[model samples]
Target: MHDDGHGPGPARRQDQGAARHEHGHSHHRAHSPSHEGARAAGRLRHRLAHLLTPHSHESADRLDPALEASARGLRALWVSLAVLGATAAVQAVVVVLSGSVALLGDTVHNTADALTAVPLGIAFLLGRRAANRRFTYGYGRAEDLAGLAIVLTIGASAAFAGWTAFERLLSPRPVEHVPAVAVAALVGFAGNEWVARYRIRVGRSIGSAALVADGLHARTDGFTSLAVLAGAGGSALGWQAADPVVGLAITAAIALMLRDAAREVLRRVMDAVDPALVDRAERALSAVEGVHGVGELRLRWIGHRLRAEVAVVVDGEATVRQAHAIAVDAEHALLHAVPRLTAALVHADPAPVAGQADPHLALAHHARV
Candidate 1:
């Protein structure tokens, strides 16, 4: 409920004073940093500036936010894919040496993962291209398409794995060189865990949701690797059917993840904003002083960031300059509250209206031309 620009900490009092002055009159007053509250706000801004300095260049590119997101996503995908390829080659060798059906299935899955890297990498690089007349939104959605393809590839791999496991389960076979299978699985587990950790860290730092999703995918594989290891170990202990059962379990897990990813990618492609995020944005906007209310709050996801457009109702008695300043303050406050917000359009309303008040209707009425 607090309407302070610097957040709801001790800075509320100073912010309230500034808001009162800004809303009451057109007089400009220099902000004095003496208030503990003002100093706290200054510090927060400084820290945020430092954290976002690297992204500044990307933000300035004039390229669509989605495109920038794709570039970062592809870079992460390429690196993870390379690691997967190397792991798959090693896994294939182990499969051949141990003659383990489970190991072979894992090798195939890894190869499938590596194959997805090709399209994902291409999509990232191509998605960043400047928008042509034919594609005004640029190729940002290419990344979402690429993500959908990756999910499909994973689903297919999982299905194949399940089929292979079912066959192995029906007709059990003796696995050769159980020790070798175990060793290979252990190596794979360690390698995948490392890759997953690195990818997750980098993905978060870059604010690339696709990369974060991919990292989660890699981490799931790591868990699968552990499952494979357990099966191979069990097979060594006279439980020959354990390997196939574990494979089926892994396949099921992958299928579930694929389903979730598919839903997320579809939503992204359709530009759906998270309902929770929309609600949070509404709260932030409504909290700004001089804003009697908020309406027509529309939010869209552009890659990892959000684009928002809202109407802010101010007192009808306020001057045009006062209303514009209130709108500007609301813009700043909303962006500060929502870091992922790339841009916002704040339409100022003369008074609060209820029951289907169209902000755009107000705009049409106020046009000078």
Candidate 2:
């Protein structure tokens, strides 16, 4: 009895073997071509990564040049202040001998500028120190504070000088030793110009806001010295009133500079990154091939460099591993584009599609609904 229910026949066995062979062939045909292509692409990517990875470290090392430039600017400030202090003392004696209120007030302003330099030098030194627990962002802001202090001091000096000049304008006074004052003003102008050039070069090279502020102050002083020379020349020619008039002009110029300095310091303290800079950052992130969109871009100034955080959307069809790799590549591209970026945090989001129920799109609809 061929248990009519189930019995293996030669024909049935041959049919099963043919079915197994067809199934295996279909599986090989489905995966083989794509697998080879993927493998080849991966090998190319590995070679590229090896070549590009070292460049990131090299770019990081370039930051040292900026730090060194800042250091040089600080040293220049100290030296310039020392020389100005000595000149102030000499001018004080000359002003006292001449009994010229304009000369005396200018000398006083120089002395105040000299005093500001002392604290600024200290702040620069401290700012360069390694970060401690007390200051997670480091002492870099000390330089900003020093800049504010210097501007305030200069502003106050300018106000006082203006007041003194006004009094002299109301009642003109005879000035003696006009030749000596003129000579001194010329020397001071030359000295200030020298320091201003040095500070500007270093500040721009390092992107140090404090150094730039100091350089501006020096340049203002150089212009004031020119005003002083004109006053001395007028006094020698018996135009005693020119001393106060030139003093008033110098005070006006100083006030303008103080306004600008205050604006810059406040911007830094408030972490206000320029809109242009933000746009640049967005462009840099979007340049990455796999990044579909960018959002929640935020940036803040950390001393000379910028700290940024952004959200990037990538192809939703990609595997989890691919999304992660794309995110890393986007980050690398951003750093390369903006060399001054100190740190960046990137969030990877899945891209949205027309018919699919994307979580991000759903959340947006819910908010609108």
Candidate 3:
């Protein structure tokens, strides 16, 4: 829906006095870079104010929200790639002018961050593909594989930064152009921090853990970028070891990012989701009028979005039409309850007696231990 950031949406506008379930997400047409830039600025500003608010529902929900979000995410990746690429290019020039290994390490890390946008962008683009026989769930899982690649990139960056740092430690060298190095370091910090904030903001909105982790990576790179300044400062102080020591510190910081990135990527691979999100889904299922109780509820990440399988108990005497209606309502409710829930499979089963056997329960399920 078009959100000009003025007031309530059409659904909320119907009854502005009361809180309502948001049935739709918001987006505005970006006619130009200034338009998108202003939106981003406004997003950060109004984030806290609209933290608990959901998108208002529209009369006709034509496009898939999940696909739209993926498209937006791809655009964000493209912009970040451009910003970081330019930042890295500027630093690379500085690295040639002033041979500071710490600056070099930071530059390498930023370059890798820019390169990472390629895989993730590919993943987002591929995620928009319709499901096929060979890949029934589409290529969403490619995002996870891309996340793995990101983790590998982080590790490789750490190794290179660490090695260069140690090599410099062993053979200390003079750092040239003290003022220029500091200026480049500041440029690096500004670029990375901006990209970090942008990525993290978009990632959270899109519910992409990998994107969020990558944002954190950019932030770490920002801080490491500052370390170059410390090295320049040391060199000015006639402390030759300061540059290498700072380089070592930058490596250590990257190692920390590697750990966090690995944790998030592995969790995606293992198909773990927040327990609270599952509980919200269960509550949504229970809210259905004909649903007697919520049974099995399973959720998994297909890239940034969630897919769910829910089993609901209904009155044994209900007609198939009634049951189908209940399932549809329950699915809609669950989708509204949990943000980023793209699809849900709801099974309507006859209500069982107390302590009675249900064959479905006896079968192996993803939920049971």
Candidate 4:
């Protein structure tokens, strides 16, 4: 589980060979040349496709190297902050020149987006702390808390945008210097799109839900900027109410973004993972030599890293040492098969015989608790 790379190493192969020999299972069917070739090809295809696809928070696997995920997350926040800050500055200048209320609100929105990086950056720093007796899991949950903050920020942005648009609708204002406003809107869109793509890519690579949510927020801001640009065009044609109407539409869009962001963060908080990952883990466990069946498998994310707890059924007559070897082999298979899986705890259970008592009943009370 602590290996530096994904594939099985020399030590792992040795252990697997020993376990397979002890179990007396033939390697012919499972380890044929064609089967190994297919598996390798499948892994390569997955890696290539993973680079382009933006997986959901539940579905994405962490790709950063050991102890480097937090560093990457922090880098993404700083870069996003810088880009968004400059974008807001340019929009602010246009706000003053045009006296356009809609443009001014967008500038403020962009500024707020830039400031969001502060909480996420702090969370990334906190995630790097080593575990102690008091916090056995370390401060990884801080990243989840940061994700909540980002969700709240998105909610606030939606509310503010809606209110501004409502007020403007009540008292429509003439937007002056339409040309300047249009140019600023384009600048805002370009800056936000770039930041969005960067943050999302890094976030997926590191499996940081907070970072991805922040990226989605930036995308919403980009759409808002485009809405402003559209309004500016309408104003140039002497339509005074166009800005507020477009602002209202942007607010609706923000609401949708808020929903998706909230769902991802809440799922993370709830320890929800994609069922496909669970199936993959089960298959890995079942393939381990001497494992009769996979009893139970559980995977959860702790701050961008994955940990597993599993139970595997082995021969009822096997001694403790043989069972332990089987468990070790199962753990090794899991680490190789599942991406971002840093640790696994495997429990070996004896397979039931026809008339034997249930071994699991010894822990029935614990399960109820």
In candidate 1, what residue range of length 10 has the lowest lDDT sum?
1-10
Task: Residues 20-100, candidate 2: write the lDDT tens digits.
Answer: 212111112122467447746865985698798654333225446446655776777788788778878787888777866
In angstroms, the error of model 2 at 14 is 56
Candidate 3 lDDT by residue in tens digits, 36-116 = 466456547545655677554332241267777798788888999999999999999999998989999999999999999
Worst ten in a row by lDDT for model 2: 20-29
RMSD of 2: 15.6
Q: In model 4, what is the error at residue 261, expressed in angstroms?
A: 0.8
- Among these predictions, the greatest TM-score belongs to 4
Which candidate do you rate higher for TM-score, 1 or 4? 4
Candidate 3 pairs with clashing backbones: none
Clashes of each: 0, 0, 0, 0
> How many steric overlaps does candidate 2 have?
0
Question: Across residues 1-369, which tens digit of lDDT does each residue of candidate 1 receive?
Answer: 122121234355334433542323344333233533554575577569869874431234423544555665666677778788888888889888876777777777777866877876776676556556787445656667777777888888988989998999999887888888887777677666777787678656655455555666676777777888888888888998998988888888788777776776777777776688778888888877668888788877544556678877876556555566567667767776775675566777657346745535646967798
Residue 238, model 1: lDDT of 91
